[model samples]
Target: MEIIAEFGSSLLIVGCVLGFFMAWGIGSNDVANAMGTSVGAKALTLTGAILVACVFEFAGAYLAGGEVTETIRKGIIDPSLLASTPHYLVYGMLASLLAAGIWLLVASIFGWPVSTTHSIVGAIVGFSAVCIGSESVNWGKVGSIASSWVVSPVLAG
Candidate 1:
């Protein structure tokens, strides 16, 4: 219970809380997407839809979510910099995650649907700007990523 007294355990607890919220959000959103057809066609009743969604969503979060987690691997930053000051890098990464999690949590609480990708990207930019200065951050990659907002839908449609 002494989260403040113990840094490692505090992080574990924080991670668990964040993980729960993240899983819940991902599941609920995906459930709507996956079951929309079934619900529309009346193939699955409302209760059936809810039950199937809750069960499969929990299973998917616990199993499939662990399949590929390279997104949190921090390969975006140079390895040499991490080695030089491990705590800074770790703190930065943790802070970025927490910031994004907080943003998502607040958004969900207020019933405002937002993209998790955008939340994470904003967090990364915040941390990168703080740690490496604005100049050190690559604007080109950021521009391209931002540009995709308009490009993807325009091309697909």
Candidate 2:
């Protein structure tokens, strides 16, 4: 649509803001989850954990985020399906980001410890299903992700 074209640049800004919000939510939740045990065991002080997370999150993203980012961007949903209407994909991604951020906020407020990965994945699935159709989604990948979510805590324990 003409509107999308006209405001394409603005959409980038919006995307960045949404991405920041989502990342913030994820970082807060994940760092707490990661450092909880250490703090509980008195192995690390709360301040130390916070400091470590601040440094390590940036380091981790800078050092190891690329492959995972690429895989998520390319493999999660077949973007080729929206080749002609790429704006839909943009809209869907934005919706997913916002959805995930809101989900994280609500979960935090309710004292329900939830995985940020699960929130984002569920948002992506819902957005893709509604925007593109269920056929466009790779359920096998989703299944794998779900299994990992279940397996991770057990493995950690």
Candidate 3:
């Protein structure tokens, strides 16, 4: 509490910086992946793909990102448990952002296919289980998400 109080502004600043990096990572990896097919098919040039991605990314985020944002913000982890140690939650989130961002950057560089959602969720689950205890995590939600990872593609097929 005291630590957070003393460094609240600093934490917010750091969080914003990390959030920017995470968004950049998403743009580099996920956006590239999305636009790759078009580029490969020669349906669009690299510049065209980038321009299309930039517009649609913003539109998608603004229009449909709320549910996802909510799930990531409050669904996976139970915030009530962190009531006594709010700082831990803050630290965990910061760490998760940094970890996901780095993983995305590396995966993109290697041309590996990856989901940005999975990376961040994995980071959050890991940090919560290790730092805050397993009970702090909502296993049911985690299970649902994990099941979807397998089920969604199969269903699509």
Candidate 4:
């Protein structure tokens, strides 16, 4: 608490910058993936796909991203365990953002499809398990999310 109070402003600034980079990475990687099929099928031109993606992405983020944001923020790890060491949570989140962003950038460059959500979730799980003990993580929630990775595709198909 004391640490957070002392460095709250600086942390907020850093968080904002990292968040921007993460969003940029999502645009470069996930957006391309979302738009690829349409472009490949010639259903939309590259420019048209970009325009459509920009509009829908903004809409989705603004209208439907809240639940996901909350889940990621609180569902993956037990926040009560970090009450005594708030700085660890902040640092972990920052590190996760940096790692996920860099990974998304690299994957985009190589034309590898990746889920931004999975990257961040894996980072959080790794950090919590390593830094705060495996007990701090919500393994059940992680398992459910992991299962969705397989289940969703199968169901879609």
TM-score of 1: 0.61
Question: Model 2: how far is 112 from its true place, Å?
Answer: 1.5
Clashing residue pairs for model 3: none
lDDT to native, each model:
0.66, 0.85, 0.93, 0.92
- Cα lDDT over the full model 4: 0.92
Backbone clashes per model, in order?
Answer: 0, 0, 0, 0
Global local distance difference test of model 2: 0.85
Residue-level lDDT tens digits of model 2 in 14-52: 999999999988876788788888999999999998998
The residue pairs found clashing in candidate 1 are: none
| Top-TM-score candidate index | 4
Alpha-carbon runs more than 4 Å astray in model 2: 1-5
Q: Compared with the true structure, what per-residue lDDT tens digits does model 4 show for residues 82-119?
A: 88888888899999999999899899899999999899
Between candidates 2 and 4, the lDDT winner: 4
Predictions: Cα RMSD each: 5.1, 2.0, 1.5, 1.1
31-110 per-residue lDDT for model 1 (tens digits): 66677789999999989999998888677658866642443344234434446555666567677677777776677667
- lDDT at 41 for candidate 2? 99
Misplaced by over 4 Å in model 1 are 1-13, 27-72, 135-138
User: Considering summed lDDT, which 10 consecutive residues are worst modelled in model 2?
Assistant: 67-76
Query: Compared to the true structure, candidate 4 yields what TM-score?
Result: 0.95
